[model samples]
Target chain A: MGGKVTCTLGEVKNRADFIVYWGGNPAECHPRHFTKYTLMQKSPFLPRGRKDRTMVLVDIRETKSAKASNIFLQVRPGKDFELITLLRAMIKDQPISEAQVAETGLTIEQLQDFVSRMKAAKYGVFFFGMGLSMTRGKHMNSAALLTLAAEMNAFTKFVAMPMRGHGNVTGADVIMRWQTGYPFGISFNRGYPRYNPGEFSTVDVLVRGDTDCAFIIGADPGATMPQPAIDHLAKVPTIVLDPHVTHTSKLARVHITTAPAGISAPGTAYRMDEIPLPLRPALKSPYPSDEEVVRRIKEALLEKPDWMGERPQMLQNQI
Target chain B: MDLKVIDHATCTFCGCVCDDIQLHADDERIHQAKKACVLGKAWFLNHTAERKYPDALIDGKEATVDEAIAAAAEHLYQADMPLVYGMSNTTCEAQRECVEMADHLGGLLDSHTSL
Candidate 1:
């Protein structure tokens, strides 16, 4: 969970056997994700990649991925826990009651089928999105998925990664993790990294009106947050980095223009599948990249020690 | 009708904001779209969805973009507190503009979570 590893998309293609898309619609969000890296593309080992590999889609709706999946499991909204539990039960070969099956809207047979497929895969990768981690169950959903993947390892190989949307969101998470032992939902006020998802999560923090100053980088929250959160954001001191006039840009205070990664600035980004790729900027823009802004922030923090606090060596290592 | 081709157009449909789409136009009509998804195709092809362009309204009657921008700016500026919102559906450039306005006006800015 806390280490630096570098690999190319070609390597990922060579290693992966099963690709699971959890709570993501690559077709709708990342139109070229599949064409460039995953499903439809040809890989080194998997010359007939789409045919050689198993593609699983786990979402609430019958999405485009589901329509094209070798295995599509539709979980009821906010009922991911029940579905995970059912999968766990099936993995254990324990008898599942009809009532439990009905609760998940999935028959025991279907659950067993999924469990068997998951268990049999040579290498399974679960790519979950905010849909699984930011909803009613929140982190619990992620925890369950991680736990299931951990459980699966008893029989085979498995890994889980979040399908971060912002071009540099995974980069942000990596930076935060490297700096503070925590990914998102972090607080620098206390001078150390504190991991409290619900308490420190962006939504809860804004909705609770806890943060007075916010530095928003490549990401925008104003247009994507709930009304309550948005209402709260309108009152805080915010720093924005973007290139155009957006709902969030309209609200920013110190707006620092930045070029879009992959289009205007070259950088590394983790695809929705957790495979890191080098983004080749197709065009140039006048703005700087978020990386530069963050580097400046780091310099500023170094100048003002009060902005950050002392931490244990173990915690520092974790970060 | 004469035909024209446009390259590197942005899709105004989803948050993906797929900007590499190409459009074939015949007069005022868009004949076809390429490099877009099902949702994007529908959005670009269909022009009869009540027309959410030019003038927008908060409650009924039409209002100019200037009026809306001013009203929104005043409402945000005047508030002892204000929340600057919505970013997932627009381009990253627009998001930057929003963040600057928020900071300048001392407001909170958050992205709307559609997921």
Candidate 2:
């Protein structure tokens, strides 16, 4: 799920006979997942469109998204590992103990039927999210699902993806990986790149009163971050470059409003599946682009004594 | 009002970034959004909202774009330990620029990466 989505969503729409949603609700998080592309839309290959594909929703409890599923398995929370592990064994035709099926709240026959359907399907896509990432045995749960997908690949085309929470979080992480060779929470303060979460993460830095001022480019931590970070942001001198008038904007010491990236200023964004798509602006914006604003800030910083007066700070700091 | 369809416009409102949105608009402003969900529609329709200032604001008062940039730059110059953040919604190109600025100023840069 990190970077290997072997099949595109378009392929999933046309070729995938079966789709599984585990621990995430696309109906709630990704509204267009069912409507625009996958289940609801009709294709030459899928003449039945929504009807042509089988949808399975596996969640801890009943969710609105379950309303769209052909099968909704209400798995007991914290037992995802046991359930998926058993499913893996079922794929290999290995017998599963009834006790395990009871823990999963599903009968052995139901599990057998699911395995048979997956084996018969032309293709399958298993999408999971926070439910798997945030649960006990976190990465292990996801790995179990991935192992299932890989094992299923032997019988039918199968792929897995994480329904990311933020729009460009995957993009951000991708960009960070390209630039710093690390995904997130990287610090270059020591004249070299350092990767640590609580120490280098934004809110943690603010909560520790480590930041004297803030140079916020496109995000609003005030609306989302913990109260302590927001309070720190409100009191500190801050520069904001955003499209809307966000919670952080109201308290911004320097609020430089810009056009929204995709709506007003066109750019590139990676989808949840790590598919890069071009964002075409529909209207002309009155304000500058985020890139332009950041470039100007970079230019402005270049003129500062802290910058112009010395070498790149990393080197200057080392001396 | 003349209404026209802008096809294949990607929604900037969310992470989904649905690119199939068709913003129906006129010579002056946007009117209706076809293929956009409720959140995307709300985002596209906001193109018509009236604001006292169209370009920028400095400490809540309207300011020219140059003034805002200068004010922000001046603030960065004064702070001994500035923190650069919130690039989750911006483009990769813009994010790199923010990183450049953060590194140049010897500031503490942070974002959704922490959370």
Tens-place lDDT per residue, model 1, A236-255, is 65645554444765665445
Q: List TM-scores for all candidates, in order.
A: 0.66, 0.83
Taking all chains together, the TM-score of candidate 2 against the true structure is: 0.83
Model 2 interface CAPRI class: medium
How would you class the docking of model 1?
A: incorrect
Off by over 4 Å in 1: A2-12, A41-48, A266-284, A288-319, B1-115
Q: How do the residues A214-260 of candidate 2 rate in per-residue lDDT, one tens digit apiece?
A: 88877888788889989999888988888777788898888877877
Say which candidate scores most in DockQ: 2
lDDT of 2 at B18: 83
The worst-scoring run of ten residues by lDDT in candidate 2 chain A lies at A310-319
Q: What lDDT does each candidate get? A: 0.57, 0.77
Tens digits of per-residue lDDT for model 1 on B22-93? 777653446577896776676556532122232323222345433433434433344443433334322333
